[model samples]
Target: MLPSCFRNICKNSVLPKKTFGGAFSKNNFATEATFETKPYRLHKLDTSPSTTVTINREDAIKFYTQMNTIRRIETAAGNLYKDKIIRGFCHLYSGQEAVAVGIKAALRPHDGVITAYRAHGWSYIMGVSPLGVLAELCGRQKGCAKGKGGSMHMYSDNFYGGNGIVGAQVPLGVGIALAARYKGTDGVCVALYGDGAANQGQVFEVYNMAKLWNLPCIFVCENNGYGMGTSSERAAASTNYYSRGDYIPGIWVDGMDVLAVRECFRFSVDYAGSGKGPLVIEAATYRYSGHSMSDPGTSYRTRDEIQEVRQTRDPITSFKEKIISANLVTADEIKKIDGEIRSQVDEATKQAKIDAEIGLDELPADVYSQSLEPKIRNVDPFKPLVHKRLGAAVNI
Candidate 1:
C-alpha cells in the first residue's frame, strides 16, 4: 500500500554540514552538499540585516519552554509505555519537536494542520492541553479524545490529527482547504505526512487537486528518513521526497533546527497564502524513537547510529547552542527552562492519572445525530466481516 513503508532504513551517514559550520551571510545560512542527487543547502529567503523580525525575550523563552515541554512529555510517555501505563501503538515524537514547534510558531491561530499518527508533538504545540494528551495516553476520560482515542485519532480546533490510515489525511487536508476557500477565508491548511505517507498514491492525487484548485495549502513531508523502521533509501526509489509534487515548488529544510524549520515553513505559508497555489516542504528530520514505542528503533538501525544522530544533530540542543552563541540566552536560562518543563510534565502526568471522569461515557455520547441515527449499518450477511462478528462488520 504505502510500499513496505519504513521497513528498512538508511543507515545514518556522516552529513558534511555541521550544527554550526554553515556559510553565513548577513542573515542567511547556506551550505553545499550532495544528497540523494541534488545539492542540499539552506537559504534564508526573508532574513535581512536591517529588517527586523525580532522576537522578544519572553517569546524566545516561551518557544524553548514549549519545545522542552514536548520533549519531556514524549519522554515520559515512552517511560510510561514501557511500564504499561499507556496502551496501544503510541508513537513518540521525541526528536521531531522542531518541525512541529517551528512551523506552528509561524502559523496564525486559524490556520489548519494535519499530520500522521506520530502526532503527539503537533497536538501539544497546537494548544492541545498537555494534561489532555497524557490522559489520552492513560485512557482516562480527561484526554482530548475523552479516552476513546488512545494514542491516535486526536483532534483539536484547527489542529486535526493522529490519523491512523496511511496517506488518508492527504485528501482530507485538500477538503479542509476547499472548505476554507469556499468560505472565502484566508486560513491556510498544512497537510503534513511522513516519508512513508509520501509514497501513498492518494498524496499525489491530492497534490494534483490542490494545484488545480489553487488552494491555500502547504504540503509538508516530514522526512524523518524512516517509515517505522524502513528508511527512505530502501522504500523510495527517489529519495528526494519534496520534489514528488511536480506542479508545486518544493523546499528541503533542516528539521533539526527550530529556526530553520520556522523560516522554511514561514516561506511556504507566505507563498500559499499569496495565492501561489500549494507549496511543498520536505523537512529533513530524524525520529529518535521507533515507529512506535515497541519497535526499539534497533531492528532496522544500529544503536551507535541512533546515538550518533542524537549526539550530533539534536534540535533542542542545537537551538540552545545558537541562542547561547548569539547571546540571546544564557546556559543557566536554558537549564531553568528545562527544569520548569520537566516539572510541568510531571504535574501533567499526575493530573492525567487522576482524571478518571473523562472516559466514562465518551463512546456512547458522540455516536449520532439528535435523532440518534447510527453512523453506519451492515445489512449483508455471509460476508466475511459480518460472519466474523457484529462489531467486526465492515462499514462498506
Candidate 2:
C-alpha cells in the first residue's frame, strides 16, 4: 500500500533480485548501470591516463540521493530564512552540490574536512544529518553545535566548523592534517576555500609549510566564477588558481561535473597519501544564488548568463540525463526521489522551527575544560557568571 507517486514509480521499475557479494544489487529501483568515464582535462598536472570510470549501482543511487537532498535542504533553508525562522548570515549551496558530493565520495571515514561559510552541503556530506543542519541554521538546541554555531559554524566528527572567517579554515585544515600524520593515521585533510580566499597571504604561507613538511592535505579552491559580489576576473590578477600553488602541484577540474570531481579527488587522495606532498585542486564551479540572502545576485552577473549555465551545465540535470540515457534509472524513479527528498526537507524544516532554543546557562559549558574554571561576563560588570569547567569531567 503506497501513495500514487510511489506506486507508479515502483510498478514498472526493475529491482535487482540477486545479491552481489552479499549485498543487494538494486540501484535506486532500477537495474545496475555503468557508463564510460568521461575524460577530464587537468590543468598543470598529469592527466589520469585511465580512460574509463564506472558508476556502480549503489554509488550511483547514493550520489543522486545525496545531491538531491543537499539541494532540497538548501532550498528549505532559503525559505526558512525568508520566513525569519533562520537568522544571521545564511549561505545556500544551491548549485555547488556536485563539489561536496564528489569530494566526499573520495573520502574515508577517518578523513577530515574543513570549508568556508557556504558549507551546508559539506556538513551533510561529512555525516551531519539534514535535520541537524536545518536545526543549526534555525538556532535550535537540537542543532549539531547545540544551537551555538549558526549557518557558518556547524561541526561534527572529523568535519571541522563551517568557519566564519574568510581564510582561517585553511590553516586549521593543515593543523588537522598534521594531527592525522602525527597520530600515524593514513587520513588526509581536505581544505576548501573560495576563489577569494586564494589571494589570502595566509593560504600561501600554509602551502609552503604543507610542502615543506609534506603534509597530507588537499587545498581546494572552489572557483565559482564570482567572489561574493565581484567576479573572479576583477578580484584576481591571474585567474589560473591551480598554478597559484607555486611549488605545490595542482589540478584544475570541472567542478560542475560530479563524476569528474570524484575522479580528481580520488587521484588527490592517492597523491597526498603516498607522501607526494600537498596538491591544490581548483574547481571551476558556479553558484546559482547570491553570496548571501542579502544580495540579489543579479547586479553583477546577467540573468541570461545564469540561465545559460543552468540550462546547459547544471550539475544535477546533467547527471540525471546520464543516468537515464544509460538506462540506469527511469525518469519516474528520479521524480520519486525528488518528491521524497522534498518531503523530507519539509519535515525537517517543520521540526527545526518547533525545536527549543539553547539556554543561557549552557553557554559557558563548552568554553573551557572543567579543570580550569573561567568567569564569563554577565549583565552586571562585577558579578560575572561562573560555571564548572567541562574538562574536569572528561578529557576534551
Which is the leading candidate under TM-score?
2
Q: Where does the lowest 10-residue lDDT sum fall in candidate 2?
A: 1-10
Highest lDDT scorer? 2
**Per-model root-mean-square deviation over C-alphas:** 8.6, 9.2
lDDT of 1 by residue, 67-105 (tens): 888888898888878888898889999888888988998
Candidate 1 regions with alpha-carbon error over 4 angstroms: 1-56, 357-361, 367-396
Model 1's TM-score against the true structure:
0.80
lDDT of 2 by residue, 1-396 (tens): 221212222243332222222333355344455444434435456556243455665677789999999999998999999999999999998888999999999998899999999999988988888899999999998899888899999888888979999999999999999998999988999999998889999999999999999999999998887778887778888877878888888876667768778988888998888787788887777888999999989988788767867886677998888777666667888899898898888888899999998766566556532435345445333444543564333211
Q: lDDT score, residue 348, model 1? A: 91
Task: Give the per-residue Cα lDDT of candidate 1 at 337.
Answer: 78
**Alpha-carbon runs more than 4 Å astray in model 2:** 1-44, 47-51, 368-396
**Alpha-carbon lDDT of model 1:** 0.73
